[model samples]
Target: MKAAFLVPVLAALWPAPALSDGVAGEFDYYILSLSWQPAWCRTTGDGRDAPECQNGSGRDFVVHGLWPQYERGWPDHCETRERDPSRRDTQAMGDLMAPGLALYQWRKHGRCSGLSAAGYYAALREAAEAVRTPAVFDDLPRDIALPPAVVEDAFIEANPGLTADGITVTCKAEALAEVRICLTRDLEPRACAPDARRDCARSRVLMERIR
Candidate 1:
């Protein structure tokens, strides 16, 4: 017999949490995942209508996904696959999200967040509105270089309550990629977990400006 090489895959055994009444309100805090707008504009072209990317407007960090996370692992897809959100809920998010993502984020991370769809959207909006963008990142130069810690410091300085322990900067191929900020369920700043801390291996990285 010829030798066989098989790769293993792990399937979710539990039903969608929403169907089983969801695991709402069980997480320790919220993860407001922000993505660098330039990266998306230059790479994915997914958020074609995002306010920051429209018609030569200044670029910025936009809401990537508002995640419902436990202090450690997170949850996903708690509702029935076909669950749909109201137009009202989606509209409330404004230009922070791309089309069709409000509902997708709700089902995947909201349901497991231990909050109703409405409540989840409310929190998402709250967290996004609360953070004041650092002046440095607001108007990115053509191509600037800085250490990850510098970016972290910028945010902590801009936001009244942010701390070094509460923000994590992640990169993609020497370009700024994402910033994960932790907040309490009530949208208060909290220390990010060790797992969420930025561990950039480089001394500095190049930040690409919006196209």
Candidate 2:
């Protein structure tokens, strides 16, 4: 009888499990995801009227998300005390990412950063600006196929400190999707986690022209 009574008391005092993956502000590094807009349009963005897909939008690589990562795994939708971003905050990111995407990213990955919405967005902008997209991809007049390593090499060349170990290229439906780069909390280039280093294995992946 006494044991049963103590069980209820201890349960109440034990503290509730976090409602999410892990606490915010507790991550090893960051992954800056730059998505190939045209490839996205050809696949998931098809039939969608998003501005990024409009003709002559000139969007090539755009900010996908800034994710908080662990050494081995990653976290998402983590419980945090920071408030969600406001419409103004989301709109401010439109130059780099769609407003809706900014909001979604904030909820999913940004929340795990433990920064306020404004701070997270600011950090995202800083990270995006730090990466230099290869100029060769600026105006591909037509679709082309190339080894994924070539793309990674181009990025490595453009960004001096970045290397094959620090970045990985991803594909969807045989099309170039995103280039993910790992960085330290201070935003310096770092080697990605082993699991995060999975590069697209296709010898020749399609890269759609800029819309």
Best by TM-score: 2
Q: What is the TM-score of candidate 1? A: 0.79
Q: CA lDDT of each candidate? A: 0.66, 0.78
In candidate 1, what are the lDDT values of residues 102-192, reduced to their tens digit? Answer: 7667766887776677777777877888887787665565778789999889889989889989988887777777778899878899998
lDDT of 2 by residue, 1-211 (tens): 0000000111101112223377799999999987777776776465556554777777777777788888867788889889998898887776776677788888878989989999999998889888988998977879999999999999999999998899998887688877899999998999998878868888888999988
- Candidate 2 regions with alpha-carbon error over 4 angstroms: 1-20
The TM-score that candidate 2 achieves is 0.87
Q: In angstroms, how far off is 45's CA in candidate 1? A: 1.9
